[model samples]
Target: MSFATPLPGPDGDPLVVDCDSCVVRSPGACGDCVVSVLLGPPQDVVALDDAERSALGALADSGLVPPLRLMTLDDPPTHRDAS
Candidate 1:
């Protein structure tokens, strides 16, 4: 049940990614997420540091890759349901 690895943010905070706990862990969401785009399918966890996050954001903004659509339970349910 390892949710996320300790990925340090810009300010030394941790950026945790718990895919299994995500409310929007669906095929559609997974297919369009930056993690999936860069690292293939969704795993139990996907860790990314600040630089990696920034790179993904830049890539997504430039339309080179999809944005990070990992909507966990702590976040609002903006994406569609898994069902």
Candidate 2:
């Protein structure tokens, strides 16, 4: 069984996996794991525009994407001005 939608990774990149040549084949560590098969590994960061973000938000609202666990930091990292 394969995943319909791609799993989200760090920095908005989608994780992809080729189950055919996967190391964790049947009877392995991830033998009966769905999440492990679907979510392979974080590849690259996807830069999302406003429209894309809106579409993703809609998909999340409709329960297409799995629920995520978010962590909030007391002091978030500050970005330097590029001026």
Candidate 3:
């Protein structure tokens, strides 16, 4: 599957899920991820807003659903001159 790019969400909140960048992306992890649980299977990208994220967090906290297991890559390192 292709990596997910951030999308514009409600209130200008950017996308929260980038499965391709996730560090724990796997069949087992996907099954427990909120994206997979709610959206079903994996997709190229999954966009979620602040409200949606909060709601999902609540559900996960209440044990109603699994939390989002998205561990994306860290920020890229800055370049420096060796000379």
Descending-lDDT candidate ranking: 3, 1, 2
Which of the numbered candidates is closest to the native, going by highest lDDT? 3
How much lDDT does each candidate structure score? Answer: 0.59, 0.34, 0.60
lDDT of 1 by residue, 4-26 (tens): 32222344444666777766678
lDDT minimum window of 10 residues, candidate 3: 74-83
After superposing all C-alphas onto the true structure, candidate 3 shows an RMSD in angstroms of 9.5
Predicted candidate 2 versus true structure: per-residue lDDT over 6-83, tens digit per residue: 323344443333333333334443433333333543233224444554455555557665322111132122311111
Model 3 bad stretches (over 4 Å)? 1-12, 75-83
- What TM-score would every model get versus the actual structure? 0.70, 0.33, 0.70
Q: What is the lDDT of residue 52 in candidate 2?
A: 51
Off by over 4 Å in 1: 1-10, 76-83
Q: What tens-digit string does per-residue lDDT give for candidate 3 at 4-49?
A: 2222234657555778887767888788777888889866787776
